[model samples]
Target: MFNLENLFGKSTRGRRLKSADRVSGALPFITAGETDQGISAFIGNDVKVFSANTTTIDMFGSAKYRNFKYGGDDHIAVVHTNKLPKYASVFVTSAIHKSSYNGQFNYGRNFYAKDADALDISLPVKDGKPDYEIMETIISAIHKLVIKDVVLYVEKKKKELNKLTENANAVKC
Candidate 1:
Protein backbone atom coordinates (compact mmCIF):
# COMPACT_ATOMS: atom_id res chain seq x y z
CA MET A 1 0.00 0.00 0.00
CA PHE A 2 1.21 3.52 -0.74
CA ASN A 3 1.55 5.48 2.43
CA LEU A 4 1.56 9.24 2.52
CA GLU A 5 4.28 9.25 5.16
CA ASN A 6 6.68 7.45 2.88
CA LEU A 7 5.89 9.51 -0.18
CA PHE A 8 5.46 12.99 1.25
CA GLY A 9 8.15 12.81 3.96
CA LYS A 10 5.60 13.76 6.54
CA SER A 11 2.96 11.84 8.51
CA THR A 12 0.70 14.50 9.94
CA ARG A 13 -2.85 14.72 8.65
CA GLY A 14 -2.27 18.28 7.48
CA ARG A 15 0.69 17.16 5.45
CA ARG A 16 -1.20 14.30 3.92
CA LEU A 17 -4.40 16.05 3.00
CA LYS A 18 -5.52 19.26 1.36
CA SER A 19 -7.27 21.30 3.99
CA ALA A 20 -10.70 22.69 3.29
CA ASP A 21 -9.53 26.09 4.33
CA ARG A 22 -9.23 28.63 1.59
CA VAL A 23 -5.73 29.71 0.58
CA SER A 24 -4.84 33.34 0.75
CA GLY A 25 -3.79 35.21 -2.38
CA ALA A 26 -5.40 32.51 -4.47
CA LEU A 27 -7.44 34.51 -6.92
CA PRO A 28 -9.56 32.93 -9.64
CA PHE A 29 -8.84 33.87 -13.23
CA ILE A 30 -10.89 32.97 -16.27
CA THR A 31 -9.86 31.65 -19.72
CA ALA A 32 -12.37 32.24 -22.45
CA GLY A 33 -13.10 31.74 -26.16
CA GLU A 34 -11.52 28.29 -25.98
CA THR A 35 -12.01 24.82 -24.76
CA ASP A 36 -11.67 24.19 -21.10
CA GLN A 37 -7.97 23.90 -20.46
CA GLY A 38 -5.79 24.48 -17.44
CA ILE A 39 -2.43 23.53 -15.89
CA SER A 40 -1.79 23.05 -12.24
CA ALA A 41 1.55 22.41 -10.61
CA PHE A 42 -0.04 20.19 -8.02
CA ILE A 43 -1.04 16.61 -8.52
CA GLY A 44 -3.32 15.55 -5.68
CA ASN A 45 -5.96 17.75 -4.13
CA ASP A 46 -4.23 17.67 -0.75
CA VAL A 47 -1.55 20.28 -1.17
CA LYS A 48 -0.64 21.66 -4.54
CA VAL A 49 3.01 20.86 -5.03
CA PHE A 50 4.70 22.71 -7.82
CA SER A 51 6.33 20.20 -10.12
CA ALA A 52 6.13 19.24 -13.77
CA ASN A 53 4.71 15.78 -13.22
CA THR A 54 2.54 16.78 -10.32
CA THR A 55 0.94 19.59 -12.25
CA THR A 56 -2.49 19.12 -13.84
CA ILE A 57 -2.37 18.80 -17.63
CA ASP A 58 -5.95 18.33 -18.76
CA MET A 59 -8.89 20.20 -20.19
CA PHE A 60 -11.50 21.43 -17.71
CA GLY A 61 -14.68 23.51 -17.50
CA SER A 62 -17.96 23.21 -19.39
CA ALA A 63 -17.79 21.80 -22.91
CA LYS A 64 -20.32 24.30 -24.10
CA TYR A 65 -17.87 27.07 -23.34
CA ARG A 66 -15.44 25.65 -25.87
CA ASN A 67 -17.94 25.66 -28.73
CA PHE A 68 -18.91 28.84 -30.58
CA LYS A 69 -22.58 27.97 -30.66
CA TYR A 70 -23.00 29.94 -27.48
CA GLY A 71 -21.35 32.94 -29.03
CA GLY A 72 -18.06 31.59 -27.64
CA ASP A 73 -19.34 32.34 -24.20
CA ASP A 74 -18.28 30.83 -20.91
CA HIS A 75 -14.68 30.79 -19.75
CA ILE A 76 -12.42 28.50 -17.78
CA ALA A 77 -11.14 29.98 -14.56
CA VAL A 78 -8.05 28.88 -12.66
CA VAL A 79 -7.69 29.40 -8.96
CA HIS A 80 -4.14 29.90 -7.75
CA THR A 81 -3.67 28.75 -4.22
CA ASN A 82 -1.10 30.92 -2.46
CA LYS A 83 -0.31 28.40 0.21
CA LEU A 84 1.33 26.02 -2.20
CA PRO A 85 3.29 23.45 -0.22
CA LYS A 86 6.97 24.14 0.34
CA TYR A 87 7.71 21.31 -2.02
CA ALA A 88 5.77 23.18 -4.67
CA SER A 89 7.63 24.00 -7.82
CA VAL A 90 9.32 27.38 -7.55
CA PHE A 91 9.41 29.04 -10.94
CA VAL A 92 12.51 31.21 -10.57
CA THR A 93 12.52 32.21 -14.21
CA SER A 94 9.15 33.91 -14.37
CA ALA A 95 6.22 34.22 -12.01
CA ILE A 96 2.86 32.76 -13.04
CA HIS A 97 1.32 36.21 -13.51
CA LYS A 98 4.13 37.42 -15.74
CA SER A 99 4.12 34.37 -17.98
CA SER A 100 0.34 33.99 -18.18
CA TYR A 101 -0.16 37.52 -19.49
CA ASN A 102 -3.13 37.48 -21.89
CA GLY A 103 -3.11 33.67 -21.56
CA GLN A 104 -0.26 33.39 -24.03
CA PHE A 105 1.80 31.18 -21.75
CA ASN A 106 1.16 27.48 -22.28
CA TYR A 107 2.32 24.91 -19.74
CA GLY A 108 2.10 22.21 -22.46
CA ARG A 109 -0.38 20.23 -20.39
CA ASN A 110 -4.02 20.27 -19.60
CA PHE A 111 -4.78 21.02 -15.98
CA TYR A 112 -6.85 18.03 -15.05
CA ALA A 113 -6.55 15.02 -12.78
CA LYS A 114 -6.91 12.39 -15.48
CA ASP A 115 -4.26 13.94 -17.70
CA ALA A 116 -1.93 14.60 -14.81
CA ASP A 117 -2.16 10.97 -13.80
CA ALA A 118 -1.22 9.93 -17.31
CA LEU A 119 2.16 11.64 -17.11
CA ASP A 120 5.25 9.49 -16.87
CA ILE A 121 6.81 10.59 -13.62
CA SER A 122 10.32 9.24 -13.23
CA LEU A 123 11.61 9.54 -9.75
CA PRO A 124 15.40 9.47 -9.58
CA VAL A 125 16.60 6.83 -7.14
CA LYS A 126 20.12 7.16 -5.80
CA ASP A 127 20.85 4.09 -3.73
CA GLY A 128 17.61 2.13 -3.58
CA LYS A 129 14.98 4.77 -2.96
CA PRO A 130 13.71 7.56 -5.15
CA ASP A 131 14.68 11.06 -4.16
CA TYR A 132 11.42 12.98 -3.93
CA GLU A 133 12.89 16.44 -3.50
CA ILE A 134 15.33 16.00 -6.31
CA MET A 135 12.62 14.83 -8.61
CA GLU A 136 10.37 17.70 -7.64
CA THR A 137 13.13 20.25 -8.24
CA ILE A 138 13.92 18.85 -11.63
CA ILE A 139 10.32 18.98 -12.70
CA SER A 140 9.93 22.50 -11.35
CA ALA A 141 12.96 23.65 -13.27
CA ILE A 142 11.56 22.16 -16.45
CA HIS A 143 8.27 23.95 -15.98
CA LYS A 144 10.01 27.24 -15.24
CA LEU A 145 12.23 26.98 -18.29
CA VAL A 146 9.31 26.08 -20.50
CA ILE A 147 7.24 28.96 -19.21
CA LYS A 148 10.16 31.35 -19.58
CA ASP A 149 10.70 30.34 -23.18
CA VAL A 150 7.01 30.78 -23.85
CA VAL A 151 7.02 34.26 -22.37
CA LEU A 152 9.95 35.29 -24.53
CA TYR A 153 8.32 33.89 -27.66
CA VAL A 154 5.03 35.61 -26.94
CA GLU A 155 6.75 38.93 -26.29
CA LYS A 156 8.63 38.70 -29.55
CA LYS A 157 5.47 37.94 -31.51
CA LYS A 158 3.63 40.81 -29.86
CA LYS A 159 6.44 43.19 -30.78
CA GLU A 160 6.30 42.09 -34.37
CA LEU A 161 2.54 42.50 -34.48
CA ASN A 162 2.84 46.00 -33.06
CA LYS A 163 5.55 46.96 -35.55
CA LEU A 164 3.45 45.77 -38.49
CA THR A 165 0.38 47.61 -37.22
CA GLU A 166 2.37 50.78 -36.74
CA ASN A 167 3.84 50.55 -40.25
CA ALA A 168 0.42 50.03 -41.75
CA ASN A 169 -0.95 53.09 -39.91
CA ALA A 170 2.05 55.16 -41.00
CA VAL A 171 1.48 54.18 -44.63
CA LYS A 172 -2.12 55.35 -44.39
CA CYS A 173 -0.98 58.66 -42.87
Candidate 2:
Protein backbone atom coordinates (compact mmCIF):
# COMPACT_ATOMS: atom_id res chain seq x y z
CA MET A 1 0.00 0.00 0.00
CA PHE A 2 1.15 3.56 -0.73
CA ASN A 3 -0.10 7.11 -0.85
CA LEU A 4 -1.72 7.70 -4.21
CA GLU A 5 0.53 10.66 -4.92
CA ASN A 6 3.72 8.64 -4.35
CA LEU A 7 2.65 6.17 -7.01
CA PHE A 8 2.35 8.85 -9.66
CA GLY A 9 4.18 12.00 -10.80
CA LYS A 10 1.66 14.67 -9.81
CA SER A 11 -1.99 15.34 -9.09
CA THR A 12 -3.82 18.60 -9.64
CA ARG A 13 -7.28 20.07 -10.02
CA GLY A 14 -8.56 21.36 -13.33
CA ARG A 15 -9.62 24.95 -14.01
CA ARG A 16 -13.24 25.95 -14.17
CA LEU A 17 -14.76 26.22 -17.63
CA LYS A 18 -18.41 26.94 -18.05
CA SER A 19 -20.74 25.41 -20.63
CA ALA A 20 -21.99 28.70 -22.02
CA ASP A 21 -18.43 30.01 -22.43
CA ARG A 22 -17.30 27.01 -24.49
CA VAL A 23 -16.62 27.44 -28.19
CA SER A 24 -17.38 24.44 -30.38
CA GLY A 25 -14.49 22.47 -31.91
CA ALA A 26 -12.48 19.22 -31.61
CA LEU A 27 -10.97 19.24 -28.13
CA PRO A 28 -12.77 17.17 -25.52
CA PHE A 29 -14.08 19.06 -22.49
CA ILE A 30 -14.22 16.72 -19.51
CA THR A 31 -16.54 17.40 -16.58
CA ALA A 32 -17.74 15.62 -13.47
CA GLY A 33 -20.02 13.13 -15.17
CA GLU A 34 -19.79 9.36 -15.65
CA THR A 35 -21.17 9.20 -19.16
CA ASP A 36 -18.94 9.40 -22.28
CA GLN A 37 -15.86 9.19 -20.07
CA GLY A 38 -16.82 12.48 -18.39
CA ILE A 39 -16.74 14.44 -21.61
CA SER A 40 -19.45 17.10 -21.57
CA ALA A 41 -18.60 18.65 -24.91
CA PHE A 42 -15.97 19.36 -27.56
CA ILE A 43 -14.64 22.90 -27.75
CA GLY A 44 -12.06 25.04 -29.51
CA ASN A 45 -11.31 27.24 -26.51
CA ASP A 46 -7.70 27.63 -25.47
CA VAL A 47 -7.52 25.70 -22.21
CA LYS A 48 -4.84 23.77 -20.37
CA VAL A 49 -4.72 20.38 -22.04
CA PHE A 50 -4.15 17.33 -19.88
CA SER A 51 -1.83 14.65 -21.25
CA ALA A 52 -2.83 11.26 -22.51
CA ASN A 53 -2.63 8.11 -20.37
CA THR A 54 -3.72 10.09 -17.32
CA THR A 55 -6.64 9.49 -14.97
CA THR A 56 -9.31 11.94 -13.87
CA ILE A 57 -11.19 11.69 -10.60
CA ASP A 58 -14.38 13.68 -10.47
CA MET A 59 -15.65 15.67 -7.49
CA PHE A 60 -18.03 12.78 -6.85
CA GLY A 61 -14.98 10.43 -6.74
CA SER A 62 -15.69 8.61 -9.99
CA ALA A 63 -12.38 7.84 -11.63
CA LYS A 64 -11.91 7.45 -15.38
CA TYR A 65 -8.92 6.59 -17.58
CA ARG A 66 -8.11 9.12 -20.28
CA ASN A 67 -6.17 7.94 -23.34
CA PHE A 68 -6.51 11.21 -25.21
CA LYS A 69 -5.63 14.83 -24.51
CA TYR A 70 -8.50 16.75 -22.94
CA GLY A 71 -9.49 19.84 -21.03
CA GLY A 72 -11.28 19.46 -17.71
CA ASP A 73 -13.50 21.50 -15.44
CA ASP A 74 -12.63 22.50 -11.85
CA HIS A 75 -14.72 19.61 -10.58
CA ILE A 76 -12.10 17.14 -11.85
CA ALA A 77 -8.76 16.11 -10.42
CA VAL A 78 -6.08 15.10 -12.90
CA VAL A 79 -3.76 12.28 -11.87
CA HIS A 80 -0.58 12.12 -13.89
CA THR A 81 -0.20 8.46 -14.60
CA ASN A 82 1.21 9.35 -18.00
CA LYS A 83 4.72 8.30 -16.94
CA LEU A 84 3.57 4.71 -16.46
CA PRO A 85 2.94 2.27 -19.29
CA LYS A 86 -0.56 2.38 -20.79
CA TYR A 87 -1.66 -0.91 -19.21
CA ALA A 88 -0.19 0.02 -15.85
CA SER A 89 -1.94 3.39 -15.96
CA VAL A 90 -5.19 1.57 -16.65
CA PHE A 91 -4.56 -0.61 -13.60
CA VAL A 92 -3.92 2.47 -11.51
CA THR A 93 -7.17 4.03 -12.72
CA SER A 94 -9.07 0.97 -11.55
CA ALA A 95 -7.37 1.16 -8.19
CA ILE A 96 -8.31 4.83 -7.91
CA HIS A 97 -11.93 4.04 -8.69
CA LYS A 98 -12.02 1.20 -6.17
CA SER A 99 -10.45 3.35 -3.51
CA SER A 100 -12.39 6.58 -3.94
CA TYR A 101 -15.70 5.90 -5.63
CA ASN A 102 -17.69 4.49 -2.74
CA GLY A 103 -20.17 7.29 -1.89
CA GLN A 104 -17.58 8.77 0.45
CA PHE A 105 -17.16 11.92 -1.61
CA ASN A 106 -20.29 13.70 -2.77
CA TYR A 107 -21.70 17.21 -3.31
CA GLY A 108 -21.05 18.33 0.26
CA ARG A 109 -17.64 16.66 0.49
CA ASN A 110 -16.28 16.84 -3.03
CA PHE A 111 -13.09 15.09 -4.07
CA TYR A 112 -10.16 17.22 -5.19
CA ALA A 113 -6.45 17.04 -5.95
CA LYS A 114 -5.60 17.15 -2.25
CA ASP A 115 -8.02 14.32 -1.62
CA ALA A 116 -6.32 12.26 -4.33
CA ASP A 117 -2.91 13.00 -2.89
CA ALA A 118 -3.95 11.78 0.53
CA LEU A 119 -5.75 8.70 -0.73
CA ASP A 120 -4.12 5.30 -0.17
CA ILE A 121 -4.13 2.55 -2.74
CA SER A 122 -2.89 -1.02 -2.81
CA LEU A 123 -1.08 -2.64 -5.71
CA PRO A 124 0.63 -5.94 -6.35
CA VAL A 125 4.04 -5.79 -4.71
CA LYS A 126 7.36 -7.45 -5.42
CA ASP A 127 10.73 -6.73 -3.86
CA GLY A 128 9.01 -4.22 -1.57
CA LYS A 129 7.73 -2.12 -4.46
CA PRO A 130 4.76 -1.94 -6.78
CA ASP A 131 4.86 -4.71 -9.36
CA TYR A 132 4.00 -2.64 -12.42
CA GLU A 133 5.03 -5.46 -14.74
CA ILE A 134 2.47 -7.74 -13.13
CA MET A 135 -0.16 -5.05 -13.37
CA GLU A 136 0.54 -4.64 -17.07
CA THR A 137 0.42 -8.36 -17.69
CA ILE A 138 -2.84 -8.77 -15.82
CA ILE A 139 -4.56 -5.94 -17.67
CA SER A 140 -3.25 -7.20 -21.01
CA ALA A 141 -4.63 -10.66 -20.35
CA ILE A 142 -8.00 -9.24 -19.38
CA HIS A 143 -8.09 -7.16 -22.55
CA LYS A 144 -7.44 -10.26 -24.61
CA LEU A 145 -10.19 -12.15 -22.85
CA VAL A 146 -12.67 -9.31 -23.39
CA ILE A 147 -11.77 -9.10 -27.07
CA LYS A 148 -12.21 -12.86 -27.49
CA ASP A 149 -15.65 -12.69 -25.91
CA VAL A 150 -16.68 -9.83 -28.16
CA VAL A 151 -15.52 -11.68 -31.27
CA LEU A 152 -17.41 -14.81 -30.27
CA TYR A 153 -20.58 -12.80 -29.70
CA VAL A 154 -20.26 -11.13 -33.09
CA GLU A 155 -19.76 -14.53 -34.77
CA LYS A 156 -22.85 -15.93 -33.10
CA LYS A 157 -24.89 -12.89 -34.14
CA LYS A 158 -23.72 -13.28 -37.72
CA LYS A 159 -24.77 -16.92 -37.80
CA GLU A 160 -28.20 -16.08 -36.43
CA LEU A 161 -28.63 -13.28 -38.96
CA ASN A 162 -27.67 -15.62 -41.79
CA LYS A 163 -30.22 -18.20 -40.64
CA LEU A 164 -32.87 -15.50 -40.53
CA THR A 165 -31.97 -14.47 -44.08
CA GLU A 166 -32.28 -18.06 -45.27
CA ASN A 167 -35.69 -18.39 -43.59
CA ALA A 168 -36.85 -15.22 -45.34
CA ASN A 169 -35.68 -16.58 -48.69
CA ALA A 170 -37.56 -19.87 -48.12
CA VAL A 171 -40.72 -17.95 -47.30
CA LYS A 172 -40.36 -15.95 -50.55
CA CYS A 173 -39.87 -19.20 -52.58
Task: Give the candidate number with the greatest lDDT.
Answer: 2
Which regions in candidate 2 have their CA more than 4 angstroms from the true location? none
lDDT of 2 by residue, 5-122 (tens): 7887458877888888999999999999878878999999999999999999999999999999999989999999998999999999999999999998989999999999998988
TM-score computed on alpha carbons, candidate 1: 0.34
- TM-scores for all predictions: 0.34, 0.97
Error of 2 at 101 (Å): 0.2
Using TM-score as the measure, which candidate wins? 2
CA lDDT, candidate 2, residue 101: 96
Clashes of each: 9, 0
Question: For candidate 1, what is the lDDT?
Answer: 0.33
- Write down the worst ten-residue block by lDDT for model 2: 5-14
Cα lDDT tens digits for candidate 1, 36-121: 33311122233422322111111331111111111110122222212233333232112222222333224453333222222222
